[model samples]
Target chain A: MRPKIYLFGDSITEASFDDGGWGASLAHHFSRSVDVVLRGYSGYNTRWALHVLERVFPAVDSGGEGVGDGVVPLAVTVFFGANDACLPDRCSAFQHVPLHEYKQNLLAIVSFLKKRWPTTLVLLITPPPIDEEGRLQYPYVENPLGLPERTNEAAGAYAGACVAVAGECGIPVVDLWTKMQQFPNWEKAYLRDGLHLTQIGNKIVFEEVVTSLREKGLSLEILPVDLPLISEIDPNDPLKDFQK
Target chain B: MRPKIYLFGDSITEASFDDGGWGASLAHHFSRSVDVVLRGYSGYNTRWALHVLERVFPAVDSGGEGVGDGVVPLAVTVFFGANDACLPDRCSAFQHVPLHEYKQNLLAIVSFLKKRWPTTLVLLITPPPIDEEGRLQYPYVENPLGLPERTNEAAGAYAGACVAVAGECGIPVVDLWTKMQQFPNWEKAYLRDGLHLTQIGNKIVFEEVVTSLREKGLSLEILPVDLPLISEIDPNDPLKDFQK
Candidate 1:
């Protein structure tokens, strides 16, 4: 079976197969090398995600390596906190996960994945920065009060917590929150609806993910293409290269 | 685990994750509901593809049910014959398989897949109409003799054979060869090269595949969402609906 790289997250991750989505680009980049699996649940926060973690992934086994089905992923990306950063008093407060709980939930998810697939690379991605103005302009739901449900500062707090958790767990991190903010006019440029990514924003995430994976020795350059290239095939005996 | 839809084909399928490719659009369409697995080989013909068929798909098993891993794909799309349509005397003859062999190989593939997982929906996608004029305008390789390697008429023949195979096997097929030419100016509108698809062409394939799958009782409206919808969770006790 082809080695798999799983993308686990919320709405942003759910939309990662859309045109110009980071996940789609990653799938293209790793075509014939690794299967990029999307396990995103839109509108989900870290707390809500915990409930379905075991069902979505394999349970811990006594063998200490590989699942019972013998499908251990090469890497699993945990991208959460966007919904968790919602303010408690807002209309979307149901999705709000407390800061401490957010970190703990992420840690729990990473621990579960690591325990199940001992050698699987666990990478954490900080939620992209919140554009309060954009959120107010394009509210996902009717905002009678006309207030943003999520604040940039609150999201930053979650991003900070996310980075700290990665440090505690010794895994790679993609600090999208800080990275997107580094750009000028990011509110209009990187975001489509304050929370979701624009095509350009998706490219940024794709690049960062590739860079992080490359640093961790999973570069596209090193990964083997699944089958023989056309140039490798012997025209006189075409089946020579295809024989498994 | 989420059910999977496997895409098996040639170069066009290999490049299906590129910008505006049909496979990526399908993945987005089936996001969260099904995992779209790409098993495309860039220059593979139906004959060459047979050698790796068993490795790519599960071998025939006892009990006439799922494979050893208990993973039976929900659907598999067999999209080949583009390379096999190449004229025998052309510079690309190495990729050609005789018309009879082409049909037989497809029959063998469908038979193997059905025997392995009888319940899995097998769909065939006929090669798209070729544009011989466009092939010369943007030749894939040097054509010193200035002769097109493939002709629209020859491709139509292969497409016919593909459709016939699907009929014989009692499986659904997307007749891209006929469907694409229905539009005026399709040579430029649907195809980028004489062989590969443009973004609009990808959309056409995507729509046709969806329509065929829907006709076969795999409509998105009927497919279950993977997890609890945000509206299903109670605001007061969000975790209530998430319990397994």
Candidate 2:
């Protein structure tokens, strides 16, 4: 009866199971214990995610709200705002939400889930910094407006705002935007296209996410010891020790 | 909430998450959809497994009993008998449960699980036939006894008995014993040491497990279309179609 960890966010979280996605890394790391559920909605921001959360999660109390029907998660990583950070004038009009509202929406979402799963640990992940040069050329995510759609500076603002909201809400925050920039020429080294994570980018996020999790004391080191080490059990009449 | 599927077996199931294990294949294949719980206890046979079942699984009617705390799984794979097929006269006495008891133990395990999770699909996997020639060479599992630990003949008999029990229980069976032999020189190609699955063997089990699950109409195709496909959703407001 391992506890569940929900990865809730955008395309980054959704692609966690990709060839070398962070989700796969976590899955491999937490092999036999801790079910990692992916609830990432690609191309979704805080606004769209808020609309879809009820549908995605079952209600803790069915009270007609039809959400939170699933088992209570042990932890949830709410990683969003990449799409919300889309420059309103430059990017798709449909995806943009005012930065103030974006922060409020995140707080509301976190509060809602925390109310349902009081024991669940919440980790907020700010989207990685955008890459303007990569956006102008190569296989970047298509922007309908023909404009760059987002600049590293703008997305980084949303990332900072995300960390602020997480701080106010008293939850762990993985500031990938700031973290990825630590390396020189991080745009190509970390991100694949302008936005989505490459294998290396995924690794950076994975390390940061794991580091934050360890800081919160919900570390991976506690995983292996959680399951029954059957080989260590007494060979003959092992049922004695097998008893709870 | 994604329902769980338990990979219940010995070392084979235990190592299912190992780099190229079939369990990982299933996890990767059904990412974000099914919870593949690993309940593999190494070096344990059907006899020990039967003893540990109540502890490993939740008791249906806890009525005073403190078990049955976990979520009801969608399915369970009862794969055992590799060690049970050990020669009683020549191998480690503790592991060698006679073939007759092995069949009964499988039935008891199934009946117990069915009683708790009546709706859960049960898939019994017959152990891969032991490769004596391979076991004697290079790096096979150590056999403390001078005589070979298991014989293909004995394992095949248990496999036959397993299919028979499954037929009686109206459950599915993955007959690796017979299936592996279908390939020429399967010893080295399929069996890494002699008993456990090789990389190719894991693929074989993964395919068979998936095939049987599909036969039961629980294929991965049934995964819910949860996220909003930006292209599919109306550009203006797509929340209407987002409803179940």
TM-scores for every candidate against the unseen true structure: 0.96, 0.80
For chain B alone, what TM-score does every candidate structure achieve against the true structure?
0.95, 0.88
Question: Residue B138 lDDT in model 1?
Answer: 89
Residue-by-residue lDDT tens digits, candidate 1, A63-96: 6466434668889999999999999888788889
Residue-level lDDT of model 1, residues B46-93, one tens digit each, is 988898887677543545466444578889999999999998988788
Q: Kindly report which residue stretches of model 1 are placed more than 4 angstroms away from their true locations once superposed.
A: A60-68, B60-68
Model 1 / residue B80 / CA error / Å: 0.4
Residues B50-110 of candidate 2 have per-residue lDDT tens digits of 8777667755353623224335677899889887887777635556888889989988999
Worst 10-residue stretch by lDDT in candidate 2 chain B? B62-71
TM-score of chain A of 1: 0.95
Cα shift from native, residue B142, model 1 (Å): 2.7
